[model samples]
Target chain A: MTPDALEGALRRPFAEPANDRVLDAAREAFEDVGIQRTTMRDIARRAGLGRATVYRRYPDRDAVVAAVLMREVRVFLTWLDERIDHIEDPAEQIAECFVAVVTGLRGHSLLNRLLTLEPAAALPALTVDAGAVLAVARGYLAAKLREHQQAGRLRSFDPEPAAEVFVRLAHSMLLSPPGCIPADDDAWSRAFARTHLVPVVTG
Target chain B: MTPDALEGALRRPFAEPANDRVLDAAREAFEDVGIQRTTMRDIARRAGLGRATVYRRYPDRDAVVAAVLMREVRVFLTWLDERIDHIEDPAEQIAECFVAVVTGLRGHSLLNRLLTLEPAAALPALTVDAGAVLAVARGYLAAKLREHQQAGRLRSFDPEPAAEVFVRLAHSMLLSPPGCIPADDDAWSRAFARTHLVPVVTG
Candidate 1:
């Protein structure tokens, strides 16, 4: 699939239940045996679908992995929207968003397994090959920042750069997880966002 | 070497000219043929040292690579001290430091070649196995931040976390440069540091 189509699928709710089943099976397989050991046949077997059926939908294991990851992003985005939709202050929204994303992803079983068991396989997707993931996240954040700007709740500067910074910071924290940051603590995350992150957009 | 010994060696100015020759040779070999292709014998040959001598100093190729990398960090820290020594304002010091580090490493021939030609091999030392590197950088930045704090030029905060943030951001940019940030531009990096990075410490 094209990048735009994949992005669209990521943003929109799952329209195909069959695809959801495949993604679920793939995620389970990855979590169980890790990405290195998981295969198309395994995913198909877990999903109770024929190998040809799974292959018809996803051309290869990589495609299936990408689809599962995209689905996870969509799920996280939906959860983020629900969690932060009620916060009135843009700064608070951003802070809570940061906390939610860091902790949420940290708690994801499949992601945690992949990171621990298959760092070489997983690191590239989250780091160097993360253009699509970063773009989706940046888009989501920029839109929220823009909304706040239009409402006069946020100071007017280019939200795109600020959003990108936030995304990169979160990305780095999740991937490397510095020993210094209390990334798991909600209170610390909020205070940190207020001090370091909110100012970029507010300035 | 013990971790403490490694840290001490990284901080101290090069004392052994013979080891320096070995490192210089290893760097040249790494640059010429890449890390995977360059063996300890090649480094020894290039350094005009016997294989037994090289093996005596460094138990294996990884040890030599680590030592060479540590030397690079020392070189960078010395350069950073010289670059930002005269800046009175803590914020400007931080900004210039950011610019110097990001641009300097980006321009480093060995690091650039490794990143471009051998990402899989180069990435771990910079990411998951980057604790030592990150710790050294954090120590440098934290000490600078502490100096400013004591001088009343910056606000009181945990400099370690703030320093880690700076290091991690630079790490992320170097590893997976986002499209939105003009990371290579000095002016842009300065502005970004001023807006986002400075506040974490100053606040």
Candidate 2:
């Protein structure tokens, strides 16, 4: 399917009170305390709803945490796919993708809180389970590379190896970020894209 | 200094019982039980020594843990340095370093034990002040890069960026190693060297 079609599926209104309120409460509770420490009652209290009501929405802490993270992951990937889908240049596509990614992922206030307050609880959700959460990123990047190759804009490089490098680089950035890369980031995005990405992907 | 002279000046037997055996005991205890849960008695039991003896050698668990990590680090770096110093090609040297590094580091051994058994206790010692680990690695890698530039085997690439990439890639290998790469062995060393290392380093 085209990027347009995939993104169209995610275009939803913020008009639904219960779903919005449930997510909002989960986000607030997770931010104030953390994923592991926050109770269902805490979310209920923040949302000013019954504890049973919160449980009805999210059966467990892991489920709540995953829901929050999953939303962020999906939005981020969707933004990337929409942003880069039109860019014809492989180097530009990569550069724009990294910029959109670092900016989009880092700017999410909930993720920042999750990473900051309780990395122990949150890191596995993001890093491990490579099969689940990060598959979006891996698949998105791989598809982009394949598009570049088919367009004849890319050099003699395999999409899969390039994807491996990209994913691993993202993982490293997530863990021990460098000061040079503005936590408001884009510094390493330029560095990586210009120096490494262009050379590897371009003819 | 000449290579031999430098080697001689740097070399020492820090293998004194207070140092080596203390570190050895810490490693063994950390290996068996969790590092946080393992007491002085546990270390003493592993070493077949008294609690007083363990304390006499190393004052506390943190010191013992650091000492143990430092010893292994020093040996690993030395082994890396020897390989780098012998290579005339900068690309080859950098590739060798990555291979040695991935081989030395990628495993569920030291870090996996730390993460699974005792996350709270081991996090600090893992990153906060783990000897002069990065400083030593950067120095050795920079020297190798500098030598390679002089020989005109590689283009004028910044050693700092090269070193940064090296460390980051090694960290990636450790965190989410490729399926092909053996957990305990460097069997995939040549392939990784050819694919990832050579592409990045060869100017």
**CA displacement after TM-score superposition, residue B180 of candidate 2 (Å):** 8.5
Off by over 4 Å in 1: A1-10, A16-19, A47-60, B1-10, B17-22, B48-65
Residue pairs clashing, model 1: none
* Candidate 2 wrongly placed segments (more than 4 Å): A1-23, A44-59, A79-85, A99-109, A126-131, A179-192, B1-20, B40-71, B81-85, B93-100, B106-108, B116-139, B178-189
| Candidate 2 clashes between residue pairs 3 or more apart in a chain or in different chains | A182-A185
User: Ignoring the other chain, what TM-score does chain B have in each prediction?
Assistant: 0.90, 0.70
C-alpha positional error of residue B130 in candidate 1 after TM-score superposition, expressed in Å: 1.0
Report each candidate's C-alpha RMSD, comma-separated, in the order given. 3.9, 5.1
Question: Candidate 1 on A73-173: residue-level lDDT in tens?
Answer: 77887788899978889888988997898788778777777776787777666667677777777777787887787889977777777777777777777
Top candidate (DockQ): 1
lDDT, candidates in the order shown: 0.77, 0.62
**Highest TM-score scorer:** 1
CAPRI verdict (incorrect, acceptable, medium, high) for model 2: acceptable
Q: Model 2, A128-152: lDDT tens per residue?
A: 3333444445556766777767777
